[model samples]
Target: MKVVIQRVKEGKVKVNGETVGKIEKGIVVLVGFEKGDIPSFLEKMADKIVNLRIFEDSEGKMNLSLKDIKGELLLVPNFTLAADCKKGRRPSFQSSENPEIAKNMFDKFVEICRKQIPVETGIFGAEMEVYILNDGPVTFILDSRELFQGGLS
Candidate 1:
């Protein structure tokens, strides 16, 4: 699984010109399911995201977690994150999970997040227009395999 996490002041998603989900003063998370993604890491990913110290504290240091600020979350499925662009000019989607499997995994990820905070979501596999007011313009890309493999300190 791959996720692009953005610290945002606010975010929203619209489908068919109708607002579907929105959040304020929190994070906008774009998630993608890659082939061979482990489902067990879904919960771990949720825990990591909610507790990630990407928010600033009084000392102007990144020391606060989303739960500390009672922040919301906006989750959106973005399978394009798995696009393979190393070869031809056109990206390849062979690394992405099948839509049927990915939709279930996306739902599971969202359910896990909703348990931790107020959660909003873009419809899985829908044509969504996402709007974000990024806070600190802070962002991070998370991969479950990397996290489990101790790729970061």
Candidate 2:
């Protein structure tokens, strides 16, 4: 599993010109699942995300977690994040999980995330437009392989 986490003052997702998910004062999480990705990794990733000290404290230091700020979360499925683009002009989808499996994993990820904060989500396998008001322009990428082995360094 991989996630691109962005701190945002607000975010929303639209499908077929209709708003499907929206959030205020939170993070916009673009999530992807690869072959062999599991629910345990999703759980760990959620814990890491909500607890990450990416938000700034009163002293202007990045010392507060999402839990500390009582923030919301907007999760979106993005299979392209797992695309293999090393050799060819066209990206390869071999690393991406099958749609059915990926959707299931995505749902599990959302479920884990909702336990910690208010959660919003984009529809799986849908063509969506995402709008974000990024806070501090702060962003981070997380991979389960790296995070679970030791630290998210």
Question: For model 2, how does the per-residue alpha-carbon lDDT over 30-149 read when each residue is reduced to its tens digit?
Answer: 999999886779778998999999999899999999999999999999999999999979999999999999998898888888888999999999999999999999999988997787
The most accurate candidate by lDDT is 1
Predicted candidate 1 versus true structure: per-residue lDDT over 1-23, tens digit per residue: 89999999999999999999999
Model 2 CA deviation exceeding 4 Å by range: 150-153
The TM-score of predicted model 1 comes to 0.96
Cα-based lDDT for every prediction: 0.93, 0.92
TM-score of every prediction relative to native: 0.96, 0.96
Provide the lowest-lDDT 10-residue window in model 1: 144-153
